[model samples]
Target: MLRIKLKWFHSLRLQLFVLFFLVSAIPFMFFASLTTGRIEAYFLEDSKAEWMRQANLVVSQIIQTNNYLKEGTNYTIFTNKIRELSQSEEVNARIIVVDPLGYVVADSSRIDLNTTLLNTQIFNALNKKNSSERYEKAGNFIMSTAVSIIDKEDNDKVLGAVLLSASINDIYKLLEDMESQIYFLSLIASLVIGLLSFFSSSIITRPIKTLMKVVQRVTNGQLDQKVKLNGKGEMAELANAFNHMTEQLQLVDQSRQEFVSDVSHELKTPLSSIKVLTESLMCEEDVPVEMYKEFFYDINSEVDRLNVIITDLLLLVKLDRTEIMLNINETNIKHLIANILKRLSPLARKKDIEMIYEANKEIYAEVDEVKLTLAISNIIENGIKYTPEGGQVKVKLQSDMQDVFIEVEDTGIGIAKEEQGRIFERFYRTDKTRSRDTGGTGLGLSITYRTIIMHTGSIQVESEEGIGSTFVIQIPIKHV
Candidate 1:
């Protein structure tokens, strides 16, 4: 039982319920005390008033024969009348006639009838005839009195007191009994409320638990794992979000696995060819001397393609881990773009594509010279690769107070809308056929995106199929 209780307290939902029960029960227990007090007060007030009334009846009867209470002549008759009245009911009653000076002339319940009642209580009552109530010193009794006496008129103006006492053993006993009953009820009530609260908490937390399980499955490589929480409300919205995330994640994982397999195949194809062709060339008897030159050139080109793929893959790995720190300087943007254009102008000339810079004005910004140049170069290079003869490639630089912008535009075959969103994903190629024939590694845009972002910048692409594409980069003017 103790271990079970400990486990209950350990559960978050049950713990909350137990704490709520304790806090609520405290106030409820105090309220029960007040209720019991009111019950006791009401019982005592009504009971005392009724008992006082019955005791005063005997006093009223003696007042009718009140003359006997004054002198010794009829004292015996008065005592007999009081005794008769006292025995008539079960209420303990005592009649004591004390002189204004504290002499006990008669006491109905006192067997030694003539004993002097010189107690301070009797003197106090005789001195003032109005009634008063008090408890016994022992704390066991409630005592009250109604005092009436003969006025010195000898016609018997009532001058003595009637003393009434009721034992309150039952009042306190009743309060204890009521307390026991209330505690029992509270215990039962707490158990019931705790159970209800536990069930309610479980209901509220169930959807979140399902989400956790789904995320765990996803983490364990089951990227297709999805949760269903169809209850109409915020939980439903969360479930929808989880499903959407799961779908996107599954797509990403499939693409990543395909990318690895593609890399292996791409690397293996060239290496296998080079190895076979080289071995054939080494066998002088199998290969003709005329074919050696072409074979060596083809092997070198394949080696160059392999080297480029490995280099792009290495750059991507470095960017992904953020291990490459930017070595920044305050450099003139005008000089940088001029240098890049100069290097690429011969390629544009060879293809008859127009290479142009929109703005000739000097722009200044704090940036890493190598990374910013690389980002701009990658986009422009991509533009140069895809653009046909007579196509146009343009570079622009501009700035505001908060940011600097670099935009590369090309009148080349633009990407389809469906492919534009994943343009920056690693190993993602825009035109699969063109990418394969041109031997592109597909990490150019991905590396450009990561490098620009590392400088607290954003890169975006605007494109329409068969029209053109513009790649824009916005970098903060100041760096920390």
Candidate 2:
């Protein structure tokens, strides 16, 4: 269970869910805080204003009654009026009337009378100024507004002050309710966002999971496993690329199996022949000298054939190495082809085939002469071996500023289009029986292809079923 929880914590889906939840919830919390603060500010300011208005109304009534005039001063009538105003539902508060000396003349609650009330709002009122203040008193929030009563006869003379103090506990309660609602809404939104993130993460990781499973199967030698492609995006492209890689792996596996089979068959055939010949000589009590010589000769030929196959296989292994070094040199390509043709001239002549060489100009290129010679020799030899009697084989060389081109055309049995693609594969033969009869090991073209690729060059074949074939080779003039 702990392991499962750890895995979930580390998963992309969980990470995305957390990211989305915080992205939405954090801002919602900030907005809720800001809204609550503003509401509190607005409510406090409006309540204070209303209380100030009430204080001003009391000041106006005191002025009209001439209560502040020494001869007309009536504390009893003024106290009654203050009490009457304070009892009204809209003015539900403690109302205090203070003389200019800051002594409370009357209180609506009837508690602060005759007491010296000294506060910032009371002081400001004594100076003919109206002011309001908010503070905590007796564990309750209180808002107090104080207004000055001015003498009608002398505009600057301050009569007294009316101070109204209201409890704001209901406002706080309302704000607390609003905060609860905001928290509830935020939680709901976070859950919705978390669910959305989980699904989105699933959509993204589904293809990756499929790819992982396919890779595991491939590691277990299931090269045929493939990912099923879905919608178009980077994930789709990744699946397509993985499928292509698996296909190549499957082909390589098949080719490897075929290579083993072919090598075994090729080696076994000569060994079997040599075994039969030796067995015959041993089984016979008396053998003629001529018969002995023929048997020995046959055994020697088989041995040489076996040697050839081994040598070719070893060379292929060397070429397949990633760090195989080439003995690169600037060589006269025309001379090289000429030498190959000269060496193979006898074989062409035996079949009564005409060999021709064409060159537009003398071409020089950076190449591994020994390897390149073997590559070109194999193609030319195949041409001579496969062509009908009296047919022609032609070798052409040409060059441009940066590359050299060699074209070898043979009037031989051509290859089919479908089989051309696999001709360069190891141990692949268009006609297996004909290839064996021609003494072709089927590694020639594969070796040639790898050699050219090492030189950063390219080779292609154009052939028809009944017509002739053309092989084109292109190599860079300078090695990079």
Candidate 3:
């Protein structure tokens, strides 16, 4: 249990939660402390101001009596007056009257009477026209105020001074209470912030944790594993991107498996035939010359088939590369198509298929000549191969403002609708036995598809089984 808690404490979520909590709570706590201190200071100043006003009033009254100016005069009347003024619930203070020489004559809190008070406020109030105030800090804030008692007839003449000293005990007590309240509020705020941060961290990290699990599964070769998340933000976009990547990985894995199966099947067929023919020759004790020649020809034919398959496989590999450069040039499309049909005329004649070419005008387009010729020849050859004896194979070329189109139509044993979509895949054949007889490597259409794609072109087929098939190729007029 302790280990689990420690692990959790070490996790990024906890760290983020704590960081957020601190970010939210620290400033408020600091501001609260700052405000409390200001309030305390303001209260102390206000108390000092109040006492200064009170001292002025007491000084005004004392100056009117003129008792301090006379020698051997009793201070009973002045003392009684000071005592009466001091008896107030709101004012917790000591009031003292000092002569010009700084002797403490009458004190409301009478303990320090007859002693000379030595302080900046007392000395300044006695000498200067303005009252002076000062504060001292000990266990609690203490405030002092002093005012000069002047002769009424002559304002410049300083008779004596009245000093008031007050302990800001009430203000300090109020501040102590406020501090306690602030501390309580801060505690509550911290707890609330921590809880909110913890929940928020979970909300943010949930998707990341889910993605981590998905990544782990993918690392374990589970290519189909995907991150399922929903929202409208960066994290949601990230999840969608991850799912897209997984889909691509799954497709690549599937393609790899299919390719392995196809290659093995293609290689095994020729190898098995060659092995059987060679074994037959080896087992024959006294083979005739004609029989040896036939067996050797058969073996040579299988080797040639193997060579075609391997060559096609290598070409497919080269075409699959991302960095293969095209030898692009402006070539007359009419001339190109004419040459392809001329080259394949022998094959068409052997099959007794009528070859036809139709175009309204000569077309010119940017293309890789060798590859484009190969692609066109593959489609036309397939048409001738698939068509019955004396069947019609038509080739049409047309062009628009931006693109040129070529259509190869054949009256052939057409492909099944279900199998049409996969015709362009490597080593995919509609009729494997017939394809072998016709010397089809199964890579021809695949090469044609990839070559057109590399040139930013598209191809589509329209076929009905037992009727006919048409392959339409579209290539851009200008290479970009």
Model 2, residue 273: C-alpha shift (Å) = 1.5
lDDT per residue (tens digit) for residues 91-155 in model 2: 87888988788988889998888899978889998897788888997888888899887878888
Model 1: lDDT to the true structure: 0.76
lDDT over C-alpha atoms for residue 226 of model 1: 79
> How far in Å is the alpha carbon of 16 misplaced in model 3?
4.7
The global Cα lDDT (0 to 1) of model 2 is: 0.87
RMSD of each: 6.8, 6.3, 7.0
Tell me which of candidates 2 and 3 scores higher on TM-score. Answer: 2
Q: Give candidate 3's whole-model lDDT.
A: 0.84
Q: In angstroms, how far off is 126's CA in candidate 3?
A: 19
Ranking by lDDT: 2, 3, 1
lDDT of each: 0.76, 0.87, 0.84
* Cα-based lDDT at residue 266, candidate 2: 90
TM-score of 3: 0.66
Clashes of 3: 0
lDDT of 3 by residue, 208-277 (tens): 7777777777777888887788888998999899889989888788878988998999899999999999
Screening candidate 2 with a backbone cut-off below 3 angstroms (N, C-alpha, C), the clashing residue pairs are none
Q: TM-scores for all candidates?
A: 0.70, 0.69, 0.66
Pairs that collide, model 3: none
What are the clash counts of all predictions, listed in order? 9, 0, 0
